[model samples]
Target: MTGEPGGAATDAMQFWDERYVSRRTEHGRIWSGDVNSTVEQQLKGLPPGSALELGSGEGADALWLAAQGWNVTALDISSVALAVGAAEATKEGLSDRIEWVQTDLATWRPSAQYDLVMSAFLHSPVEFPREAVLRRAVSAVAPGGSLLIVGHGGFPPMSEHAHGTDFPSFPSPDDVLASLHLPSGWAVETNALIERTAKWRDEQDVVLVDTVLRVRRDE
Candidate 1:
């Protein structure tokens, strides 16, 4: 029952459930638009089809994808966050385009293939079987489709400084891909390191580094 951002074996879903209960509708650092731009760029030009959005928080990206005509299934362990996300979808009249699921990614099993599989800012708290997970996700993508994985890069300002004394450090793109151990037929369409800086209310720059990777499953 581990949650979206894989961490420990003890109900990952519960971990996020608690976090979301406290924050309600507020977006976490992982929800920044600047970070999502890189993800949008990677998804550009994809046709409307079935999509699975992993760790979907607040439905920001999922709602946008549905607006683009994609049939999106957004999965998250946090009921509170998903509730707010559902409300947003309703507000945007996208409720019909999305199927919200409350599930833990650590134990989630793919029942069918999809045109696109997306995982954004899914930073695991501890070492995980990433390669196995990515490979499984890729396997879930139909041939001639794609898999996109985006997350906070390992190296950045304050990246090593730790978050509030209890947050887990982010993972690098290489670590993710390495965990996947992609097959030979799949080609990496785009791979880039994105550096994003945000101006806080205190005039301090909060640097966020994220990695974007796009892989096309061979037809």
Candidate 2:
């Protein structure tokens, strides 16, 4: 597979694809189904609108957003994961509410703006072509819209993470914002690392350090 971000050593798409193909049983859900406590807490009381979920593995958050009255677009590089997400949406009778796209962020172009743009666990162990990914996500946001980014903080220590996994080390929220290199008009709402338990298939009792940010673009 072509490695856009992180280069030849570990092409994320290939690595994830292999993991999907080799899995013997379900990997158990890794994210909470509840409106994503971090995103919800930061966005509480905020009005809803169109949303886009990046690296939307299995679509748990996307499905939840659709239920919340947001028009949602969920994208992922893994067709296996996308298929599973689509099946879940069908089961929930929400197939009509979500637009699922299979595209590689390494080269995919943003088609339109969204009220909220989100990235959850789209971390990579190696340094990614950070500018490309961040710019793409930011460009997808409409003016007056919000951008939310959540990633595992380097807590629970990188040692606790599964070996050989392609997960990325967490950057501080400020660093993430800086990397986005957003145009002059975007306003920062929140940027910090929030500690919380990952209410999913977490087994190691590891505390989840999430780098969370919420930014609003000027109209």
Candidate 3:
């Protein structure tokens, strides 16, 4: 959701903290106040269960999943972001259904397997151990569980920020799947590029290309 230099010590955490704090000051919330369309659509047929969300900024997806009867643990690097999300969940009477944790995905190891493990738009500005983190995420999926990952396929028109500037090149669906190295009994449900129209600042509409991957671990 926010981007800054990630190479220096504590830079990633500080960068996210500052971004969320500034967003809270300016907009009160950093992202759109709705569940991501890709997530919503992908989870439509799946039954609710224990879910883990990495980089769950503002908890939109986590809150939505909890409302759909899934117990969720949402992790983010920014305390400000998690605080805002927690307050929102409390206000919605869904606080009991979700657990919020603050940790860097690069180093955090999964303590429990989950029925659903997901990360949406988890691109980082600084060089991150993307492959390693994803591999670990895959390992956290319980048998018969699902893993959903959505990422920016490319920048939209009229955007000032270009690829390889704030972040590295967005990984293709195949790239992500290959990095996971999924073992036998894992089935690829969806691995493709899709397009969605996004409203920037709730003003202009920009068509964003997204790489979506969904996999199911066989029972």
Query: Which wins on lDDT, candidate 1 or candidate 3?
Result: 3
TM-score of each: 0.81, 0.81, 0.91
Global lDDT for candidate 1?
A: 0.74
Off by over 4 Å in 2: 1-12, 21-35, 125-128, 155-169, 199-204
- Across residues 127-175, which tens digit of lDDT does each residue of candidate 1 receive? 4555566667877888888899988775445544444556555556666
List where candidate 1 sits over 4 angstroms from the true fold.
1-10, 24-35, 126-129, 155-171, 199-205
Question: What's the lDDT for all of these models?
Answer: 0.74, 0.74, 0.86
How high is the lDDT of residue 134 in model 3? 82
Candidate 1 matches the true fold with a TM-score of 0.81
Worst 10 residues of 2 by lDDT: 1-10
lDDT of 3 by residue, 33-133 (tens): 68999889889868999999998988999999999999999988887788888988999999999999888787778899999999999887665787898
What does candidate 2's lDDT look like per residue over 12-87, in tens digits? 6677656656762454443334466776677666677899988887788888887777888998776667776788
User: lDDT rank, highest first?
Assistant: 3, 2, 1
Q: What's the candidate order when arranged by decreasing TM-score? A: 3, 2, 1
